[model samples]
Target: MTFKIALIGCGGMGRRHAHGYIELRKYFDTVEMAAVCDVHHDVAGTVAAEIGEATGSTPDIYTDFDEMLGDADLDGIAIVTSTPMHHRFAIKAMEAGLHVITEKPMGLTLKACRQMREVAKKTGMVLAVAENYRRDPMNRLTRALIEAGAIGTPYFALDIGVGSSDGAVMHSTVWRAKKEQAGGAPLDAGVHNADMLIYLLGGVDSVFAEIAINESQRTLRPMNEVAPVLAEMYNHRREDGYDTGDIVEQTAVDTAFAVIRFKSGAIGQLIMTDTSHGQSLGVSTVSGSSGTMYRPRSRSGESPRIVRGDGTEIMGDALLDLVPGFELDDTLSTLWNGARHISSYDMDFRDIDSKILAYEYLDMVQAAESGRQPEVGPQEGMDALALAYALMESGVSKTPVTVEDVAEGRVSEFQDEVDAEMGI
Candidate 1:
């Protein structure tokens, strides 16, 4: 039952995925890292050595994906590439007779996500999206509490993700800020926010979003000491083949604010920005008819507060103590165990998140063994992307767009541009 997996892309996220594979072997059953692939041979070699040292197994390294697929005997491929290439990589892996797991926003476009889903259906391969945030403990706990009536009859919610990535120091400045590859922070991180909303609340009925580019490459850091040559060399290209500079002409929206109506008749608001002068973390709240749940900070271990309409307030460890009798569903149980692992790992959120990623691999293995779909299956990934695309459409049309509209191809604002750029 050992699943031999090969990893594609050896960047920052790929390193974490490699670590996840190592830990999956330690914590779960047999899950072996067979090979690592990246266009940058040095990066791939470095990651392979690191995994070898960590797991005592030297995984084969390759610079090309096709070489890895053609030679390595892999049961699945973990795609850590950028958003636009998700479908291409996934379809290739599935078509090669291997299961696939991909990082989010599923794919850059809804069309791409559907293509992946259709390919999986035709090939009978299991495809899962690595939505680690949905696997976060607090997210699952919140969902459980709402379902258990701890938050009473849920009616409305607010989720906010405000951060400054336009600054040169931010990791996302390279690609996530671009329109063609990532569709800005709204499509990049916004999909996660929207997915969290859908996971906790329910399917979204409609979305009204306003997207804007408040900061057109406002430099937060002066690369004075560093040579411009080094900076320019590392600056990377945008979707339009232009250099991102101190005064870079950024086309993607640095800010997005959206109002969402769930199919269950609940309403919610989502705000995301990667270009705020003084950026804030993910501060979210979900309000019900009788009480409200609030997460003041975005980090994994931060506890949420619950306040009742009658002024009863519960927070922190006390909240857990009060919910001693809460029932545990399968998903909630897995999240609880995952949360416990986070606490046990000395508050390393990166390690904790990586552990969840490991669990995602385990989900894929389970799907393969049982002939069932993965927990975060293609449809769920598609639904999340559909909401994200709908939000973008709403932003462009200055009106509300239904989830079905986007799911059914009634509205598309950015997909064609992405498709053409990707030559799909």
Candidate 2:
């Protein structure tokens, strides 16, 4: 029995999700794109046409979400709207008796996440977060290696990414610059990092952070000046109110430095910034009693390297051999084309991205059909968001905040304004 799912918010991320559905059909016949909806009818029509061309079935299109919910015969809905709309759409769909798979960060604030989780619990619907980073095979391998003593009782990790956007709005989308809408990179892209850290290391205990907004004004970077892949992505973006000529006043914090303590007695230093001019830095590594394992950026399809105290390095197939019985699960193996012990993939960004997202769709559908929770369910989503929010809350209060407190809504100075604005 195939599940019917609808696509909501047919902008850039939504279009990518449409491709994910098309890719899901290549491996599994478990779900179909039944409808597409957006505030902009033209954007929704474009995505519907693309899905139709690729899948041989055209989905019904609607400009209004409520109309789609009432008219479309959908078992689930994929919420690909802006960050602020994630919880609103997910709660509405779940209340309408449909499962939901929404983009990362779960909700605009911890309170919003709590409300969505409550609704999911009450409705018995599968609410999955589209966190693709942990689905990468490389990350899976890294987890296995850590579990197998390759890192020998991990003690600390460093996840740092510093670069300059040169005053260009991220993804050329105006909402990302607004704190009320996107919560900047720390909450936008940082949630992925937060989720991956929890996936690789363990639960976070507390966080002490300093957040800053180094750039107050942002403009669209010329197509020629941006990276080819990003430029291609920007070209597909059709946000309702965005214009190339308009300048965005950034309200979200673009830089953050945090120190984290893990529940397993490990410590971590996380630094993320997009305003470091004249210098670029990137680091992702976990250190332990015996050795240090260097990790590649998630979904990059790169191999992880481990360097022992004796200066010996292990990588590629050798790394796989270190973990006895280390292999991808049946679903992930099928998605990666039966490569089990392989360390890296040779596919481009779009190929791997779509496959991962396709896995997310399949996971959500299977969970709904079986009356089980998706792998990244509400609790996991809430934890990741809590860790990200712990950073913001710590920054706002100028004190270390426990992840548990943040997740439980005990500490929420940073999110109070956002919650008030949304009336949550």
Q: Pick the candidate with the highest lDDT.
A: 2
Error of 2 at 339 (Å): 1.3
- Model 1: worst 10 consecutive residues (lDDT sum): 230-239
Task: Rate residue 146 of model 1 by lDDT.
Answer: 77
**Model 2 regions lying over 4 Å from their true place:** 222-224
TM-score against native, each model: 0.88, 0.98
lDDT by residue for model 1 (1-424), tens = 6789998977767877877776666666568888998888877887898789988888999989888889998899999876777899899999999999899878878878878889999999999998877666656556767777888778998888887654543342446556777657777777887788888898999989888877666442423332332232223212234333444446666678899999889999988887775756767889998799985343356666789988988766666655565443453345345333121113455556666777788888889878998878888898888887787788888999998878767788656777688887
Residues 154-215 of candidate 2 have per-residue lDDT tens digits of 99999998977778877677788888885577778889889988999999999999999999
Pull out the clashing pairs in model 1: none
| Candidate 2 collision pairs | none
Q: Give the TM-score (vs. native) of candidate 1.
A: 0.88
